[model samples]
Target: MKYYNKLLLLACLSGALGACADDEIAAFKTDKPESIVEYEYLNAYDALKTYVDRTANPHFKLGTGVTESDFLSKGLVYSLVCANYDEVTAGNAMKYSSVVGNNGSMNFSTVRDLVKVAKGAGITIYGHTLCWHSQQNNKYLNGIIADKVVESEHPSEPTLDPSVISNGDFEDGTITGWGGWGNSSSRAISAAGQGHNGGHALKITNPTVGSDHYFVQTSYNVAFKSGETYQLSFYVKGASTGTGQVVAQDANYAGDPFLDKSANKDFAITTDWKLVEMKATVTADRTLILLNTGKYEGDLYIDDISLCHVNTGGGGGIVTNEYAVQSDFENGLDNWGGWGNSSTREVVDGGGYNGTKGFKVVNPTATNSWSAQVAYDFASELVAGETYYLKLKIKGSVAGNIGAGFQKKSDYSGRGDFPAMSVTTGWKEILTSVTVSGENADRFLFNVGAYAGTLWMDDIEIYREVKGNTIPLTPEEKADTLTYALENWIKGMMEATEGYVKVWDVVNEPMSDWPDPTQLKSDPNHTDTENFYWQDYLGKDYARVAIKLARKYGGDNQVLFINDYGLEGSGNAKCKGLINMIAYWESDGVTRIDGIGTQMHVTYSLDPVKQQANEAAVISMLELLAHTGKLIKISELDMGIADVSGTNIKTIAVTLEQHKMMAEYYKFIVKKYFEIIPAAQRYGITHWSPADSPDNQNSFWRKGEPIGLWNLDYNRKPAYAGFAEGLSGK
Candidate 1:
């Protein structure tokens, strides 16, 4: 993952230790032989903690992500943790799902236990997460909102009147299925509001006080199957403001409120009403779904509330009326996971065949496989054994293959790689006909993976044939519960500790791999059932919302940080990506991100040339983060000398020479942090592994390798001395 940050490189050349002239290097007193020997104090030993206390803010606690049992068991792990570090973070205990129980309940047993241990040692807990897309109870959070079934429902079986909402169009001259709520008043049937389908519509004359979102809605019972896919479609016109949002509440609306699957379609401004639709698989036998939107205290007319059972034809059949809005990219790339080693340009208008807006993707770097793509979640939308047509208007800088294939977000197997097509400079329709199957057909992927140039793509459409009007599919991420869930989780954590637990990794890994290291990760569509990619729901503004929530819940004095790995990677791609993200968040709106966490999960060898390169990257990465004017911290700092990077690791059986090399590398990085980053920007360092040997393989860094200042047996290694020297560069 090598990337060259031009601005960072320039800063390093002028200063950073690795690039300094011999005379400048000579100025570091600790590097002098006598000073090094003096700090050793004739072999007087100091814990890594002591060094941190002496040099970089003695009160500036060093932190690490640890397990609850390790500290609770009070094994060798606990002793080492207290001895070498002044702060602690639960690797998973403090996270969302781990602490959340049935419904949106809170269960902080592990966190409470860890907090006790930290309290005893005068250590504080660094809250791990309040917002994340993974490891969430997807079923619990997303499924909480169901169609609330009111008693006294007449027919128990499916009826010919397919309209889920009774009197949905208000053609009956009165509101029937419509449910007014929370200050919603002035409900009436408006003749002037005759819909695009030519009928009077239900109008909300006076909106709720804070109804900038979906407040008043239509709630009714639609008989649903436990495992069947369903969809909702309607025509909505914004109030006088020309904006509106359609929201769908869960069956348990009170328990999991504020979920809107059609958040994007909430605000399609036009006087003429347009059709909007969304797809979801029902989990419960029967439930109530609420359809509503918030307007600016004005009137909003609703018409043609209809629901249908969507048939996903993965078995290969004629298709029609697909989720066309998502394919069109008229608004922006929504629910589309964009990833690769290339730059994903903005969604530009006039780029598609229809001259509307289309997603512009470019291979900024001059390399093949400088790849990127936008993948859609077909989840239960595609039926088995159906012949489906995937079409997109595209003009490529180079001719290559683009597939509408099926693959998992993290481990895509490219099962749906269709026949390759060649397109010229002018926009052309690249169409593929594929018979759907139960193989790896989960997502509909549109890719430009290994192309060397730019690709302008838009107006994507999918269909085959339908005898009548095809049912439309627009994927909507009902985010009401998930968003509030994250907020509540953070609020709960803060309440538990009364804000004594001050710092946190508010957002993690908000950066992508190299080539376009300065951008968010675009590959690995996390739209799977197990993995809940937040970007899919919240988009790039995920960090901004997270930062704001932390500030609101944790109080004003909290130190919130954004953490990511590979920050010290070749060319500093990960680090650069984080800096760019922080900038985006701050400018996006009012946000409170305090520090930058460079999870220096690095690999290096005793090889001098390679080692030096690694050293330079570290300095430049730190310097670049410092340039952002935000607190710079080497969060989760660890280095593996293992063959994990194809270079054989110097495991426990390492020689004395190997030990010295390790010490030197540690010393170099710590000193560079202090030297390159100004005092104000220095957020201190956190050594990940206190002692090596518990279970390296499970750790993300070097699995099955030794990478700690203290040996597995708790004996201080040569690296300890090196760390001390670096921390206190006399």
Candidate 2:
């Protein structure tokens, strides 16, 4: 992290001309600085990219950036990449923040837009990473996992539509608040038989009056109001063959019958439970919804009584505008896996619509890939020839396309990816319409990801338009959310582009020097406000999950890897921690982790003992990784001079003697990589700063460090000779 400091942030906030100093500005002149030393071996061999793959035991790849605005604009940079590099990794677009927005909406336009360009040129795209702690959409995620209050359109003026009926099954006691008229003394709440849920049912024994078979209730008051519609549904049964007609009116004992007389439902009330329902409107103000059982009955039982307001309809008491919810995803995903494995989908907290617990699905980047989806049985609930509306709250690692539809369970017949929705960064309300033929409708499956990474879903509801209240889910529910997030995310990315992109840096920078446990470094640059640490919540096993996700998503052929920086430092915890991760991953039942990336951001001048110490430390680290039989890659190799102190420092030109020595270090590092690590275990090498000069004042590495193989004018530098020689094994 060059020129990265608190001062830089403060300067940007104060609207200063970047955090760089005036001297650095002067150092970066329009005119190219002439190199004092001329190299003899600069152009005698093939390009460094060709020479490395041509002579090595491994068919090594050369990767460079195509993220800079002028990557192909200067013509030289683009041609250099096209001619010399085997693969190009976008420095920023491949990162997470580039796609996810501030509101947690993922817009993969940045990624998709570039991938189109790269693919058109016949250049391959190396997925820089799948999961990492840096360059994350912290602004979106922090707010996503933050404490929130879900909004519900409940009646402000206290109303009663108990989510659950009041002792509907008579679990407590049947005659507690319930007393009937006309030979009601013989009736009582009985638990001698099985109840609806567990026990207790209202039993009406033998009755005397033939017409007064039974009458029920303490107060004939229906807990309802005017200007509202209510649906009364209940369960009833009889001992032997019994006959009865239950009436639900404005006090069936007397007063006006709110429901039509012809609509009165008749029942046999047999030995089995039967469901009967009546629909009516208050019209005017109301007091009670009375029920009278007419005719003969012996040993009758009633349980699970419910009186609730259904979705308000138009005039004429027609119950048309109602919806049967398919799933809320509140309780875990039980019968919700048909598209793929259930392990690929999970219910997580704090990601729901209206801030409730929801689910996270693997959403890949490609639109034509097998996506992460789950099933919800609504076959019995859906009405044929009726239009059903699906509503869900979703967020993703990147902006990807998605869809949903009602499908058959027996034959798995579904209009797959029919109802489309656009997934963004924030939890957004997406609506899709599915007209149900009401046949074999087994599940309402929503496909997530036609791009990259994981898609988070919450408050997944399929219901017709209705005004009501739903309970909200929140974060802090459990730790399963974080763990499952890693799982689904990896699978999503791998499944999306498994054909094109093969290699991925699974976990980036997972070691910290500041913390005691020395786990992952959280937001290394404290100045960047939108930084998220997966390790902070998931802890030590974060690496394990990353490897697992990569393996599961990318499959056996996927070149999965764990990458980190500062491996050359003397006994640095980052390097040791990386080695430890590899061991833990392999030993923890992991069979796939293809390689390890040592980001060699080395310096040209380490002053005597420190230089030797750096060399020994890197060689030891390489040897240790090689011993594991895992491939090793020099992920981001760059050499810098002109010390970058606490504040931004000027890039003063080093002596010609020092420049030659810098080139020598390049040769030495490459040579040591081949010599120490087994040829079969070599992945490849990469250069960070491809040009000798820095164009952006706020660039990632130290600006104007002359670290590239080519000079500002696109001429081969002395370092190219050293790199070429190292490749030739000279």
Candidate 3:
């Protein structure tokens, strides 16, 4: 019955054994099952890419996702990919998160090597992404836009004036208005007798050193005035020898803070009470006092903290007046309204002239300067003969003049118009002083009916200036700075791949599927260090900006695409959402998007009803994509078998019949792609998983699943024949 018994029988017949039983011979003569014979036909096909009818669809490319290291090494993966695909997209090497570092530096050695290897082998390279919310260098991006850290000189002596910050002595035994950020830091009020001076002390515990010194921080909020020097004094020490610093920053945290003293800012902390005192000139009406120990490791104790406003003898001290009206749109639209002249106005995120939310106005045609206008109603009438300083940053799609005016809301009386200012494609600041003379002017308006293009306005401020002093950079300034960063990153990437890479996914997965289908994806908190949503800061026009930058740097011949996944879902919700978003992005009529990509990471459902529904969804997706008349690419194609319970079938758990089903599903996907999409719009189909996934639980993509056309051992699979049959239109 076993292998040894059959060998013994053969040996006995050949005189190597004493005896042999007829039953043992008969036991080895069982017939092979017929079901497995069906898979033998898979051996009949040639290499996967050979079945493509290139002459019929010359632009059609057979692509595969590959690891950069495997291809660069010219190993087995290199041989297989080159023999079976026409183009290669590096799975991760070409992404923004791969090249950009936490310190905002970029390294392209891997990309350059990959390009050289692929070019030498006659394989085209496709750029993976230019902009996306996930997989970004969040640390660097956030640091650039973090609450500014303006350093003030260390005070030689402690101030005798009353403290401006509340509960500076920690005598109340509460950590109210005191908090910590970064490095998983926590704060509390120490035991009553644990204070540095026999009273409760503010206790801060930092777990580890962070990338930046400010990453571990303790902060308190207090009102401050521009140009007014403030003295901050505290007694503190750490459980162990460590270092820390203290600084003052404006409450308006749109831009980076100025540093007055970097070398002398740091102080060594030991297990002893030491007096720490510093002086800083305030900038904004509100300020945050920060105690930074991000680079240190251990617990910190502080007591008797004091911050006092330094009173100068001069009668003309800095006077801080709150703006009568301010709308950064960081929170939301601050009740701004506009309607006229076939023009529309709305507040959009990441749609700012720089990298923040801003007011956008689009005019159909040039008419009266006042035909299209945006207005903000002031609660109180402007005092007669009082000078109000109005400042705003504006830009336009085309050069034109926009009129600014003040008017009374009651009878449209007291209309006073400022001089018309010319606006160009680049952002320009308009600062003017207007003396109110009308009996009552209760509203301010931006008249843009004469501008026959899209206009963007950010950081609008109207206030009476009582005194001049240095203030924190406004929202517009911060947005502009961040815009430069985004542009520089894109430019660098384009230059690195300019030689052989002509096609790019300029924006990847820009739209969100939940809450609102047509809206762009954004993470306001940005808690994940690996995710930095450019849209959160740059606004809704992020994709347009990416496309424009790619075109400028990559040249006119380059093909750009917007790519996303889940387009083939049942309701076609994501597909419809993406289509609408694309329409909105192209509304300008100049930011041309060349194509769309649908990542078909599909599953072959074992349930009968579910399989039928999946098939219908795939067809629907292809039809919808074809209707757009744009080049449609099957960007990432892979297949896995799903059990009746919707759990993914592991590679070892998959049976021959299940493999056959996945093979047929693959055929259906490829066949419908060609049948539904016109030849002109058929960009190509790419295999995301070329080989069966390994039995690794920690794999990021389709872990331990049989999703490939080939087995892990490089053997052709049933799916290979099915894919070939689909390509040949069988």
- Provide TM-scores for the models: 0.54, 0.48, 0.55
* TM-score, predicted candidate 3 vs. hidden true structure: 0.55
* Model 1 bad stretches (over 4 Å): 1-44, 53-59, 141-477, 522-530, 642-645, 648-653, 693-701
lDDT tens string, model 2, 1-730? Answer: 1111233344345444433557766455332124322443354556566666455564677677555455535365666777777777777766767655676455555555555656666767767777787788776656545533435343333222321233454543444445556654356767645555445677766554354433533233455556666666777776666555543335434333324335645555666787766566655556655455535545667776666665542222212235445456677774666454322666777666676766767643455434456567763545556556666667777644566777776777753334345554555565555567656565676655344577777665566543333222232332366566556555555544535777888777777756532455765323446567776666567776676667666666878778888877777566777777667767867556788888888776536665677678878878777777888888888776533331322334565566677778888888888888887877777787677656476666566667777666566666777777777678
lDDT of 3 by residue, 1-730 (tens): 0111222234446542323637675455433346435555665677778888998889999999987887888988888888888999998888877888888889988988888899899999889988877777767776777655434343223223346554665654577678868878999989877886576789888888776678987888766677677777788887777778776766555212323244366776878888776767655565677788898887788887767666452222234454778878887778888779878878898888578998888999999987788888987777777767677888888766777878888887655666456575667666655677677889998888888999888998888744423334565666677788778887887778756998888899877878775677777755556677777767788788888888887787879899999889888888988998898989998888889999988989989999999999989989988999899999999988888999988989888877878878888889998899999998898898778888776477888988788788766677887798889888
The lDDT per prediction is 0.63, 0.61, 0.77
Error of 2 at 338 (Å): 64
lDDT of candidate 1 at residue 22, scale 0 to 100: 85
Instruction: Point to the candidate with the largest lDDT.
Output: 3
Pairs clashing in candidate 3? Answer: 148-257, 349-539, 349-540, 350-538, 350-539, 350-540, 351-539, 355-537
> Which segments of model 3 are wrong by more than 4 Å?
1-38, 151-475
**Across residues 206-322, which tens digit of lDDT does each residue of candidate 1 receive?**
545453554445456555666666666777765454554443334655311222364344445455676666655555565666554445466666676666555554322323444
